[model samples]
Every structure is written in C-alpha cells, then in structure tokens.
Target: MILGLHHAQITIPKGAEEQGKEFYCKILGLLEIEKPDSLKGRGGFWLEVGDRQVHVGTEDDFDRLKTKAHIAYQVDNISYWRKVLEQNNIKILDGVPIPNFERFEFRDPFGNRVEMIQEI
Candidate 1:
C-alpha cells in the first residue's frame, strides 16, 4: 500500500531559520506554510510546493556540502533559474543529463544542494 511522497526534508544550521526563509522563500519563492503548533518550538519551517511539502528542519555542526542528498524542484524555465541564481551570486553546477530534461544544481546559502529541472 504505497503512496506518493508527502514531503522531503532538508536542514539548516540551528538559529539560521531567518536566512533559510530568505533563500527558500524570498529568493526561491516557495510559499511558507504554518508548522503545526506542536512542532513550532522545534525551530524550523514548512513550505508548500504544488501539492507537496518541503520540511526545512534545523541542525548544528553538520557539513551539508559533503552529501549528494538533495531536493530536485520541477521548474518551468531552467534558463531563467540559472540566470536568477547567477544574479544572486550563487554558483551553478551542471547536472548530469537525463532524457527529455534540462537541469542544474546549486548550493543554497546554508550549503544545501538543490536542483532545478525542467522537462525538455
């Protein structure tokens, strides 16, 4: 009885929640959804993407760049995203090609690997 993904989580350094919001919300434009009251004190936030969610949690002393673990966002315009990242001084890394898709990767301000992909 398997179902589709409910959410994917990524972490930021503890107390860096405001910076996380700046990147994931102000820059990337993901909508901030209210976290459950019970989880509110845990020091993280939730985001809405289409029908799914991305849970941005908080941790400390973790090196995020050392992992390939990431979230690939489905976008409408890969080129536009590239320019946007570049304009913000975020370095873009070329992604391995997949049939019928164009994509790229970058590290968020907190060093989380993030991918942007679009159907070709």
Candidate 2:
C-alpha cells in the first residue's frame, strides 16, 4: 500500500522566483530541473535532491505560518549552510544548532520557513 514519493509542492508568493532560485539552488544546493511543458505557464521551479523532488509554485497570496507546513532538508554541514544563507542576506531563525542536531531555519522570499538539519 505504500508508494514512493514522486514529488512535493510548495506555494510561493508571486514574483519570488529569483529569490527562490537563490535559496533553493545556490544556498540549499538542490539541482534545478526543467518544468514539464504542460505546466510551463504555471510559473514555478522544480528541484531535485536524491530521489525526491520539490516544486515551488507561484501563489498570489501566501501565509507561511498560517499554512502550518514546512519542509526540512537534511544536510551534512549546518554551519556551511548557515553561512551560505547569511552571505545571501537571508535571515535565520534564532536558537538553532541544538545538541543532537545542528540546524538553521530561514524563510524564502515568499515567507516559507525552510529548515536545514544535521545529526550529531
């Protein structure tokens, strides 16, 4: 009854593609893939990591916290990711780098909170 995860979708605020590219590709190190021809005009970007893929789409209105959803990426180096995010002028959440798991949280231009974690 269980199947593999084909992909996941995240709704981004309108006009946030550039920032999304910076955060997801440059900062998070996810690979960008071409969107399917059928969804071309929908306005979004697709990213691949291992066997999973995430699709970021444009939404006229988005409320990050109100959506009660967030995505977490497992990283090998939290500090490096943190520095990358800060160097890009992205603000990170406070109180990160917990004992067993070093982590950092940041919001995309659309206000979606993304967290990077590494196990100790």
Candidate 3:
C-alpha cells in the first residue's frame, strides 16, 4: 500500500523570489500556484507538476550545491527542452543511459540538480 509523491521541496536563497519565478515558471513553463496568505510571509512558492508539485523554500544560509541527488521529471520532448535550455543559457549534461529513455541533467537557478527524461 504505497502512495505517490506529494511534492519535492528545494531550497533557494532568501530574497530571490523573482529569480525563482523566472526559472520555475517562465523558463520551465510550470504554472505558478500562489502561496497561501499564511505561508506567503515565509518566501518561496509552488509550481504545478501534474498532481504533484515542486515547493521551493527560502534558505537563509543557502549554499549552492551541485549533486546527483535530484528530482527527475518525465518530459514529452527532449529536443524541445534542449533548445529551450540552450536559449536560456542553462547548461545541459547528457545523462547516463537508463534502459529505453533519453535522460539529461541541468542545474536550476540556485545550482540544484534537476533531471529530465523522455521515454524512447
């Protein structure tokens, strides 16, 4: 009896809300869901990803870390994402082969690792 993911929480530097919006919303094309009034004072916001979400939080002592521990999103078009990322100056790394999917990795605005995969 297992359930699916609720959401994934990531951290960004405090006071970078606009940049976060630019990356997650404008760049990634995720719809921005407004934070509740009770939570709005804390900074950060949410993005709609299917039924789940990606919750970004503000970290006071945030250090930009690049690591393999990341959240992977299933995509419709790798080529489209590739072009989009390139146009936005985001670096894309060809991810290791994993069965029948095309995979890649990139860093978000705050340097957190993110993975994208499209089924072959």
lDDT of 1 by residue, 38-118 (tens): 999999999999999999999999999999999999999989999988999999999998999999999999889999999
Kindly indicate the candidate among 2 and 3 with the higher lDDT.
3
Mind giving the per-residue lDDT tens digits that candidate 3 earns over 1-120? 768788899888889889999988998899989778999888899989998989989886655664556888899898899899999999999988999999899998788889889999
**Residue pairs in steric clash, candidate 3?**
none
Off by over 4 Å in 2: 94-99
Top candidate (lDDT)? 1
Assess the local accuracy of residue 74 in candidate 2 as a C-alpha lDDT between 0 and 100.
Answer: 85
**lDDT score at residue 31, model 2, on the 0-100 scale:** 97
Determine the C-alpha RMSD for candidate 3 after optimal superposition of all C-alphas: 1.3
Higher-ranked by TM-score: 2 or 3: 3
The clash tally of candidate 1 reads: 0
Write model 2 residue lDDT over 55-89, tens digit each, in one string. Answer: 99888755676654778888888888888888888
Clashes of each: 0, 0, 0
All candidates in order of TM-score, best leading: 1, 3, 2
Candidate 3 least-lDDT 10 residues: 60-69
- The TM-score obtained by model 3 is 0.92
